[model samples]
Target chain A: MENTIITIASGKGGTGKTTVASCLAMSARQTVQFLDCDVEEPNAHIFLKPRLTREEAVSLDIPHVDHNKCSFCGRCAEICMFNALAVLADEVLTFPELCHSCGGCWTLCPEKAITTNRREIGLIKSGSAENIHFTQGELQVGTATSPPIIKAMKKTIQKNSLVIIDAPPGTSCPVVETMEGSDFVLLVTEPTAMGLNDLAIALQVVRVLDIPCGVIINRGTDVYSKVETFCRENNLPVLMKIAVDRAIAEAYAMGIPAVEAKPELREDFRKVLNHIKGVTAGERTCCH
Target chain B: MKELVVISGKGGTGKTSIVASFASLLTNKVMVDCDVDAANLHLLLSPKIEERHQFYSLPKAMINREKCNGCGLCEDTCRFEAIKESTVNPLGCEGCAVCSRICPENAIEMVDTVAGEWFKSNTTYGPLVHARLGAAQENSGKLVTMVRSQAAKTAKKLGYDYIITDGPPGIGCPVIASIGGASLSLIITEPSLSGIHDLERTIDLLEFFGVPAMVCVNRWDICPENTEHIKEICRKRKIPFAGKIAYDNMVMLAASRGKSVVEMNSRIIDEIIKVWEKVFEVLCPNMKL
Candidate 1:
């Protein structure tokens, strides 16, 4: 059996992404690797509540000052590209937050006083609930970048069963980092003009990345035909639609999956999953 | 003197529409669109670029072929795989300068590259600060800070007293950068499954940073029960719960025409102006207006 990696992404936010992702993760609980890559505001954990068994720190290599071997030359400070490293008449300041861990100062210093140290930006955590093996990352507060922590989270799914990545919202770098290399990308969207424009941006990103993608129009409405028409004209498949149901909202606020709160949602989500399986299987059959 | 950042943990949740309304209501307020990755506020504000400044995020490594040594050390030392064989992949190279450090031949040098541009421009309304980034660059949060700071400086200089901004959605770098030194954050959100979920996260982010924030529900009528749930959440968190905006078409009509909702003379604009009044009250408690 091939390990099919699936990514659920919606460029526009607040469009039932967490609701659908959580439902799919719960129903397909047996022997599935659920990786939540929305490290910025990872809400999947609120529902899953997995117990952590493994914890690892994510750090970057930044330069450390050794004043003893240093001349007050200030060359390292002057050469730093990101302004992460600074120098003064009596002191040198290295703001690790500004540093991308480039280690430029360490190499440029003739005195070799510059050494490198690891600074923790975030952490990777892994645990499980029932048949679901879950991992989610949290970028440290005030930290500017999320991709490094996301990279660590993705690494946990290596050689794992049925990996499903719940991507972060937006068509930015973090979203690309999560959706890249997935076997199928499920682009979730709603029925609004802003939703349509943002979906267009997400489509461009996925197409530019050369990933085959399809759409799942959540909160289905007659107005959402705009989305359907866009998908049709672009030759993008419309996989499934979860209607505008208030029960889904209540179920989520109560911290339970929609399928668990309302069994009917199971039928809808199962159809979504089956459609994905059919398409991926057809692709695999062709490859073989 | 005062800054208002419109942020929602969930993107496409009516942040720009709200910010545009606030901008139209408050003349002389310096406007900034901190949603750098995919900025859409300029579409409504219709900003005409007057000055442009390039944003150089990080330097990348370039190996000199004239002083070439094909030693495998540079390749082996690079953790980012920025140096592949003889060619340098600019995207992969994090400008770590590790290869330059490890190379005994000293053939590698790092140079600054422009990641994006920040623009200060004139609009029909007033001054605007916005930016556009190159694909896969990693300085979005920094760019947000730079824009906010510049906007604040401009506001302070002009005695504008208000720096109204539309922050990037989510609680990542861009949002955090938007939150710094702000008097208040006006979180515009919906009452959907993801809206409340993302609000919990965005509120926590603001609280962690010790910034006072309030919530405003867009499309309150679509899910009235969920809107009350949001109100209850605010009650529990001890944060002030602001008013709600009913689902309105006038807002869309204004945006479709590239105009601010406050600029419209329709029924929706009146309700939105009420929301703007609250924003002004929070930002300027002492103002008689």
Candidate 2:
């Protein structure tokens, strides 16, 4: 079988994205490469418990101006889209946190005074947990951008390995960055009104990206059928339904993967993986 | 006016649900939902859109094929790898305008694109401010800042006493933009290991900004030990600990009905009311409830 990249994302937070991703990794028969792309508030590390053997600082280049060489033309500040640069009568100010590292300021500088300086925005940590190869990104607190760190983490994807990505909540840039190149996306949601609402929005993102996707209803119950109705109307497959189990919630509170807490769950997760493989395989054949 | 932002470092810790309940309890406030990415507050509030404004953030690069010489300078100079064969992929482009500046044929134009939309609406509870960012759009922090400033303006002009904001999850740009300069922040956390871990990081962010913060553990009975651990950490850090809310399925039922827990008849309603009272007391020490 070829390598498959599966991303678990939810439009709302705390809907069990990490839970599903980690459990899926543990249940996979072969070695798995797990990337926790939720840099801002990465919780997969707590669940995966990978013995981090490597750490690398992810930095972006921000413009560093040399006053003696600068003509104070203010061209760099004027052209900056992020407002990271500002020019005063005698000095120029650069806000490194606000810089997007687009190389606009220095490249456009006529006086050649603006040079690049490395600003560490986050760190990428990699290690292994048993058969699972784990990597996660930690965005520096108060840093405005997470995409740079997420981009750095994606660089470590090993070829021809089962890759599972735990994406951040919400349908924003960070989520988009994680789901961009994935083979299949598993959207986890609950059967509640808010869950149905956000799930619809997240589906919009998947549609825009044109990726094959499915849904898993966590804390599943018949009390709220809207989520199921929405999924049926959209023709998205319901891969798995993990009912509202108190033991699972308790296990989660103790930093335990649901599959580990109840070994029977491993079979359920494995079945979900098979379904995904079949879906992706069908797509590849049709394209050819 | 004092602004009280309810934030949870972890998503699904009941921030929006609690805020919806507070909307029913609080009389003189304009509620603002700062979660522009996938906003859920509007679902519960049932807001009637009163004012709508297009939010323009970073400018995206647009190529004029007629003016292009096909020199491929724009593609080579682009750092984001956004340009390929003189065509810019909107998803990959960071909207930095470097291609426009470096284009030899002057074909690229930095065009202002609407990233999202913000709205001022009237709800049964009171006035509400919210926004919806376009799918796969960037600069959510900018859109969040816009929603907040609009809320503040509406609050001040209408003589509202408070700006009750429902903040986005995480300690990122959007969260920072929502809580900065706020009078107080209420960090809602669940009684899980992930919840506590995220809560500590959120507190560090609030401390970094000098924003006064309080802690409220939702579904505290889910794990009593972890809940106590969270309270101990709050005590050590000198942060006020708001009341704990018991785990209840009724909250979900109420949400499905588009109602706050306070509006529904359940034991959880009183607990939520108590939590709101504690937050209100800290927000307005001198004013009467």
Candidate 3:
């Protein structure tokens, strides 16, 4: 049971990435797993309305310093790669937010004052609605790192389930972690010059991962040719285009994916699914 | 100095476009493009980069080929799976140093990798601080913070009143980095489904941070009906509907010529001038623009 993993990502936001991902989950034949890695501001749940069945803390292994155990020594501070731990003659300080939790500091502590502790960086919640199994992550406000929690969500995927991973915006580590191991990546972008340049960067990220990617031009009617020309030279497929329509906006305000709010989007969603199957299913058969 | 940050919860909703237009309307103002990830404000502002500095991200563990030993321990201890075979990838490595420590053969070394470039530039209007993130680099939030901090120092040193920041799109770290200690934020959005949804979330984020904000609806005519819907949403939230920029081809034409639409002096330019005035009035509630 080789499941098809399709990641809906656009280097730029407000391009209907979530709208497309939630719709694809609804259009799937069997169990579709939806993972929202946009922990910063997740809106897929607002559209899908999934009743979260499980809520668990996503923690990191940070070093907790014990004040009573030892004399303040600078050895642990010198060895920390992240500079999370610092020691003075009188007191030791640990900035938990900066800690990457490599456990190096705790092991290297000369006085053995450093002990492992858990810091809740984010939360991962799982639930189901319709034919979709929904799981999403929420990065705690002010927390710097999010890729680790994204990795945790990626591990929750089951076999034979059509997975739609909604990645966060920007061409960074969080986006990379979500797009990893995906069969097909949908790079959503608008038609503006800014959109084209950002999409180019996003495309390169997927290319480095050695994954076949397709571009879906959001707001296509405004500037389709610029997007088409960029994709043409790069050999990236333009699976579908969603034009700028006001009806789609109204549905979004009331909290629903456009495809569910409008039947017209259903046709576009189907075309994208067909293109995904054609690309990913072919790769799966060849591997088998 | 009133700080007007152009921010949107989601990207590609004309934050830079509106900022460029606002910059064009004003003179003798220092503009900071705080959207460090894919900063294109310089593209429209046509700023000549005067000076550049290298931004270094987290260092990556590298296998010293000369230190020769094909040990499997480095690969097994790597938490990021960055160590595959004997080669270590800079992009995937998390800078944990687990590979360097676990290498029994002492063949691994961690090296600082240049992540991106930040620039101090002079635009036709005034000084501009911008950045370009390196290909496949993380730490965009840090780069954005650097730009704003530099811009603030420059504005104060140069004796400029207003330091306008074109913030990054989305409600995440980069945007948070932009919104810090700002006098006011002007969120540019459209009358659409994702626009309203993201706009409300953006409003919440800004309010949560206690940044007083006003809304400027871009391309409202494209969805005239939703324009009213957007207006109602703003009214319910008590967010001042600053004004609307009707959809116009001149925006793209001006951008193609490396100019802000506000410099074009079109009917749209006049409307944007009105929006800026409203922003000034609300942000300065006591003063008349």
Query: Local distance difference test, per candidate?
Result: 0.77, 0.91, 0.80
Tens digits of per-residue lDDT, candidate 1, A101-215, equal 6556776688999899888887788899887788988777667778878877876775736787888877666887787678778888876565666677777767766666788
Listed in order, the DockQ scores are 0.29, 0.83, 0.31
Model 2 CA lDDT for position A164: 98
Question: Estimated TM-score per prediction?
Answer: 0.83, 0.98, 0.88
- Count: clashes, candidate 1: 0
Q: Pick the candidate with the highest TM-score.
A: 2
Clashing pairs in 2: A13-B11
Return the TM-score for chain B, candidate 2: 0.97
Report the lDDT of model 3 for residue A48.
86
Error of 3 at B146 (Å): 2.4
Categorize the docking of model 3.
acceptable
**Which stretches of candidate 1 lie above 4 Å from their native place?**
A27-30, A52-54, A107-109, A261-268, A271-288, B42-70, B81-91, B96-128, B146-161, B189-212, B217-240, B245-274
Which pairs clash inside model 3?
A: A249-B193, B9-B170
Tell me each candidate's i-RMS in Å: 3.7, 0.9, 3.4
In the range B162-245, model 2's lDDT, one tens digit per residue, is 999999998888998998899999999999999999998999999999999999999999999999999999999999998899
Models ranked on TM-score: 2, 3, 1
Q: Candidate 2, residue A98: CA error in Å? A: 1.3
> Which of the predicted structures, 2 or 3, would earn the higher lDDT when compared with the native?
2
